[model samples]
Target: MTVLNGKGVLDGIAIGKIVFYQRKGQEAVKRHVENTEEELRRYQDAKEQEAADLKKLYEKALHEAGEKSAKIFEIHQMILEDIDFCDAITDTIKSERVNAEYAVKKACDTYIQTISAIDDPYLKERAADIRDISQKLIGILTNSESDTFTSEEPVIIAADDLTPSETVQLDKSKILAFITINGSVNSHTAILARSMNIPAVVAVGEELGLKYNGNNAIVDGASGRIYIAPDAETVRLFSERREAKKAEQEQLHSLKGKKSVTMDGKEINIYANIGRPEDVEAVLRNDAEGIGLFRSEFLYLGRETYPTEEEQFQAYRSVAENMQGKQVIIRTLDIGADKQADYFEMPKEANPAMGCRAIRICLTRQDIFKTQLRALYRASAFGNIAIMFPMIISVGEVRAIKQIIHAVQLELSGEGAAYNPETKLGIMVETPAAALISDELAKEVDFFSIGTNDLTQYTLAIDRQNPSLEHFYDAHHKAVLTLIRITAENAHKNGIFVGICGELGADLSLTETFLRMGIDELSVSAPCVLPLRKKVMETRMDR
Candidate 1:
C-alpha cells in the first residue's frame, strides 16, 4: 500500500481502479516546408477549427458546470484568437520556413515559456491554456483526434496535469475522481472539478504514475491523500466515510427552504455569490436567501471588447428576475489584479493587487462605469437589485460613485426607461482604509460586504495566490477578524447591514465568531449555503 499526499481542492471521497490518462497528440516534429503561405494557411484553418471546437466545449460546459466553470473555454477561445498569439505562429512559419505543425509547436512553446517565467502564479497557470489550444491545433493538423475515456465503469483518472480544455473534454459520468501530479488549487482544472462535485487532489508529484494503472485506489480529497492498493482496513474505513459523505449530502437537501436563523433566535441572512446570470439556477437550488455578491466582471472577461449596455442589462435583468424578488447585490467590475481582460489594455502594475482595480477602474473610466450603472438601474425594475462597489478606500470614492449614479438616474429618466429609483447602494469593505473609516463610509452606502479574500491578503501583506505562502496567508489572523468586527460595528452603528462575501465567509469555524460579532449576513458559494444554514441553526450564543 502506498499513501501519497497532495493538496485537495475539493471535498469528497472516491474508491476505484486508477487509469492514467494519456493526452492525445503526437509530438510535432520539426520539418522544413517550401511554401510558407501554404503552411500559414494550414495554421489559420486549424486555428479556426479549434475555435469552433472550443465553442462547442463552451456550450457543453455551460450546460454541465454553470457559467463560471464554462467561462474558461471562452477565455481559451479568446487566447486562440489573440493577435499576438496568431502572429507568433504565422511569423514562425514564414521566418523559419517550417511546416505548420512545427511552427505552431515552436510558437506555443515560446509563449508557454514566457508566461511560466512570470512570478505571478495566476499568469503562470495560463501557460497551460496556451499548451491546450496548441495541442488541439496540432492534432487537427496531424489528423489525430483527442482521446476519450472508454471504461465500462467509472475509474479514477491520473495525469501529470490537465489543461482546462482537456479537463472539460473528459466524460464526467465515467470519472469517479481525478488526481494530477502537477496543478494548483487556483487552476481552471481544479475549479472545474469543484464545480462538477468530483473528488480532486493536485500537486501529488510524479511518484503515482502509469506504473500504477489499474490499481485499486482510494482518493480522500478532504485529507489530500491517495491510497494506492489500499489494505483491507483502509478500504473499509474509506467506504464508511464515502457512505457518510453521501448521506450527509442527502440530508442537506432537507435544510432547503429553511430560514438561516440561530436557535437563540439570532437570525442572519445566508446568501450566495455568483459570477453570471446562468449561475442563478444554482443559487435558487441551494435556497439562499439572496445573492450577496454578484461578480459583474465575469461579463467583461473572455471577450475582445467591453460588453455593451444592452448586453449588460440583459444579464443583470436575467439574474434579478430569476431570483424572484430576492435581494441581488451586484458588485461593479473588479478587474485588474488576478482577474484581467486584455481588451481593457490596463497598464502593467508592479503590484496589481493594490493597484488600479474595482472602484479605481470605474472611477478612472467613468464611461465604462456609467454604462454599467445604467444597466444595473434599468435592470432593477425587473426584481430586487442593488449595486455594490469593490476595493473602495475612502469617502471621496463613494461620493464620486454616488454622483455618477445620480447622473445615470437622470439619464434613464430622460430616456423614459423604467427603473427603480429606490435601488440600494453598497460598498465592499476590502481594504484596511475602508475598515478604519467604516463609520464615515457607512453613512454613504446602504450596506457593507466585506471582501475578506483581499482583506486578509492586504492586511497580512501577503499574496493570496501564492501557494508557497499558504502557511503565512492566515484568514483567521487577529488583524483580519478585528477588521471585520470593526467594520460590522461601524456599519451597525450607522444603521447599515454588513456581511462577508469572500472565501472566508464560507469557513464554518468562523460562523460562531461572526454570529457573535452581530454579523447580519453570510454569503458564500451555492454549495455552502445549506451547510452554513445548518450550522447557523444549530449554533447557540454563549450569552
Candidate 2:
C-alpha cells in the first residue's frame, strides 16, 4: 500500500515499478559491472554489424521511395565515451570492497568533495553532472532489469533519482511517467527527460507516498506539474493537449534551416552554449550562428591533473573544425566554487567564488593559463576564435590580463607556434563593479559579455543558492536591467560589440528586454537553439 501526499500543483498518484536499481551483491558487484561493460562493448559491435546491414536496407528504401534521403540514424555519433573512467570506477569499487550502491554513492560523494573545493561557479555546476553519471553507472551494474512498455498499460517507476542512463533504460513506448523522490530541476535527470521528450516529475516526496496498485497519474513535464487520478474528461483533455503540443513541436521543427532574424530585421545572434565537444553537433543541427560560452572546465575536471597543451589544442581544434567557420567564444579555464581541479594543486579557499577564479586564477597560475592561451591562439588559426575573460572587475585587471595575452603571443610567435594573432579578446561583465565601470573597460577590450547570473546575484547582494533570497536576485530587476543597459550603452559608445552569456540570454521572455538593451548576441543551450531562433525570428526590436 502506498501513502500518497497531494502537494500543491502536484497530485499524488499511484505508480507501479517497471524497473528498479538495486544494490548488487558485494562480491558480485565487480563481476556485474564487468559483465555489463563487456555486454556494452558487444552491443556496440552488434550495432556496427546491424548498421552495415541496415545501410543497404536504408539505401534500398530511399531508392524505392524516390524521396529525399532519410537518415536511419544521426550522421555523427556523439559518443559519450567515458569508458576509461567507467573502467576505473569499476576497479575502484572492487578494490574498495564496497557494496554496489555504496560504491556508486561513494563515487558521487568523491566528485562532490573534489568539486566543492573549486572557486569557479561554472565548474561547480558540473559536479551535478558527475553525480548524475555516478548514479547511472551504479544503476547499470545493479539494475540488470530494464523497463518495458506495451500499449497494454502505462507503468510508473519509482526511484530516488533518475539519471541520464536510468532514463535511457525506460522502454520508450511503454514507460509513461516516472517519479523520483530526489533530483532538482538542475539535475541531469530532468534534462534527460527534456531531451527524451518524456513527462517526468522529480522531488515527489517519497515512493510510498504514491498510491500503489490502485491509482494512475499524468506528468506535465513542461510546467513541472502532475495530475492525480483525474476523471475521464480531465485525462482526455490532458491527452489531447499533449498531442497538440507534439504537433506544435513538429511545426517548430520546420523552422530549421532558417536564419535567426527578427521580423523587423533585428538580427539576434542565436548561439549555442556548449560544454562537451560532442555537443557541437547540436549547434549545427539547430543552425546556431556560433558557439558562445564554451566551458573548457570539462577538459580538466575529473582528471588527475591538467591536460597537456596538445591535449587542450586537440579539444579546442575539434570545435573550430566542427564549427566549419562560425564564431566560437572560448572562456579561459574557470575553476572555482564547486569545481575541484584535482591536479592543479589549488588550496581550498574559505570563499572560492570571490577568491581565485577566471582571470584571477589565470594570473596566479600563469603556467596553466599560457598553455590554454597558446591552445586558444593555435585553434584560432582554424576559425573565428574569441577569448573571453571571466569575473573581471577592474580596468587594471583587464589591462594586466591583456599584457599576459600579449606575452603568450610573443612567446608563441618566437617559438614559431601555429596561431592566430587576430583573435578577439572579450570580458565577462559578471561583477557589478565591472558593469559599473564598463564605460571605461569597453575601450580596452574588443567586446563585452554580460554574465547576468552573477551580475544579478552580486548587484542585489543575494546568495542564489538560498531560496529565501531568490526573489531579490531577479535578473529583470530594475537595477540589474539598468546595469545591462548601461553596460551595453558603454560598449556601443566605445564601438565594441555587446552580448550576454547568461541564462538571461536564453530566457525567451527576456529576449525583448535584451533586444531593447541593444544586446548583440544571445547564447543558449544547444537544445534551446531552434526555439530561441524561432523566437528571435518572430520578435521585432522596437529600436
Candidate 3:
C-alpha cells in the first residue's frame, strides 16, 4: 500500500522507518580565493561558529521547547546579523574572489531566492531560515561535523523543510514522526511539532523523498495519512487506529482538573494562548483558565532594538509570576501585519492586512506605546496583569487606548514604581470595525478577545495568506459567524467579558458554536487546551 495525504499539523501515531534527514555538507567549490583577507577571516570564523551553534540551539529550545521554541534560535541569531544577510555574504567574499564555502553558497542562493519571492507566507517561511543558517555556515566552512540524524530505530522524518535548528537538533526519542516536503502550519518545524507532542505532517509532496529510505511508514497524525510500504492488512488497519488515538489522548488527561463546564451548566473560561515567557509551561500543562493571548509580540520579534522597558518588565514579570494568580491577557505590540519587524522601519505596504497594524502600531508609536505601557504597568506588580489591544477599530481607538493607558498609569505612579492600579483593559474585537462597535467597544474595554484570525481575515475579504484563498477561506463564515455573533452580543450587552483568541479559537467545529455565542472565553493553543476542554465537556446547552 502507499497512501499519502498531507496537512495534519499534529496528532499521534507513527509506525516508522523512513528517515531522509541528511545535513552533513559537501557542495561548495568555486575556488580561486587568493586570500580575500583569509576569506574574510574564514567568514568571521564561520559566523562565530554559527553564533556558538545558535547559542546551544537557544538553550536547547529553552529547555526542550518553550518561549515559542526558543524563539527559533532568537530568529537564527537575528538572521546571523542580517545587513542584507551580511551584505550578501560580504559581497560574495569580496566580489567573487570566492571561497568562504563559495561565498556561503552564493549568499545562500541569493538569500533563498529573495525569500522565495515573498508574497509573504510569513516571508515564505523565512526560506527555511536561509536554509538553516546556510547549512550551518557551510558546515563551519567545510570542517563539516555532521549535525543530526543518526537514528538506529525510531524513524519517519522526511524533510525538504524543518529549520528551527533542524527541529532542535533531533533525537526527540529518535523521532518516530516527521514529514515535510515544504512546511508551514506556521513553521518553526510546525512550532516544534506542536510543542513536541510530535506526530506531524506538512505539505507532503516531492513524493516524500530519499526514495522511501528504510520503507515501512505509517504516520496518520489523525489522518493526514502517510502509509508508504504498508500492507499486512495495512498494518493491521493502522494498528487499531493507533490504539484509538492512544486512548483518546489518555482521555484528555482526565479532562485536566475538569470544569470547562457545559452540559447545561455553561461556565467556560478555558484560556491559553501565548508566545514567550516560556509559554507558561504549556499554560500550566494545559489546564489553562488564564492567559487569553499574551503574544506581546514575543518582546518584538527577533530583536535588534525596542525590547527595553526593562526588557518589557522582565518579560511581563515572567508571565506574571508564572501565572500563579492566573489571568495574564497582555497583547499590546502586535507588530505590523504578517508580523514584519525589520527594526520597525515599516513602510512598503500594499495592504499589509489593512496596513499600519495592531492598534496601528500602538497608536502611531506613542514612543512605542509608552514603552509597552511602562512594561505592562511594571508587570502589574507581578500577577493577574491584563491589557490587550490589537488591530482595533475605534471608539477612537478605544479612546486612544485609554489615553495611552492613562499615561502609563501616571508614569507608574510617578516612578514610585510597583504597579497594578486595577489593571484590566482590552480590545481586539478583530476589526469588522471592532465587530460593529461591539456596543461602543464594549463600554471601552474590560474584555473582548475574538481575534478570529483577523476576524476571519477581515470578514472574508479573504487573503488569509492566500493559498489561492483556501477555497474562499471561511472560518465558518456566516460572515465570520456574524462577526463572532456581533462580538459576542456586544460583549454581553456591555458588561464586557468575551473571548476567542483566533484560529477560530481552536475550531472543534466551532466548539458548539462558541458555546452558543455567549462565549465568555476560549483562547486556545496550549495543544488546544485539552481539545477545547473536550469540546466543552461534550456540549449540550440543553441539547
Leading candidate by TM-score: 1
Question: For every candidate structure, what is the RMSD over all alpha carbons to the true structure, in angstroms?
Answer: 3.2, 10.3, 18.2
* Alpha-carbon RMSD, candidate 1: 3.2
In order, the Cα lDDT scores of the candidates are 0.89, 0.67, 0.81
lDDT of 2 by residue, 1-543 (tens): 122332222222223333333323322233334444454454344334433433443333223221111121111011112454445445554665444555555655776787779765434445655654444344444543333323455566556665443355455556666667666654445544544445566776755343443356655555555555666776777778867767877877898877778899887787888766777877787778899888888677644678888998999998998898999999888887655554677776897777777778888878888889888998898888899999998989888888888998899989998888878999999988998999999999899988888898888877665443445567678998899999999999999999988878878998887887789988886767888877888887665
Which of the two, 1 or 3, has more TM-score?
1
Best by lDDT: 1
Q: Using lDDT as the measure, what is the rank order of every candidate, best first? A: 1, 3, 2
> How well does each candidate superpose onto the true structure, as a TM-score?
0.89, 0.71, 0.38
lDDT, candidate 1, 1-543, per-residue tens? 999999998989999999988866576999989999898889888988887898788877776776668878877887897889888888888888999998888888998888777786767766888888888999999989787667889999999988877788888899999899999888889989998889999999988778999999999898899999999999999999989988998899999888888898889999999887877888999999999999897778766799999999999999998999999999999898877788899997998888888888999999999999999999999999999999889999999988998999999999999999999999999899999999999999899999998899999999876665777788999999999999999999999999999988899999999999989999998888999999999999856
TM-score-superior candidate, 2 or 3: 2
lDDT of 3: 0.81
Tell me the TM-score of model 1. Answer: 0.89
lDDT by residue (259-286, candidate 3, tens digit) is: 8997788888888887778768878987
**Total clashes, candidate 2?**
12
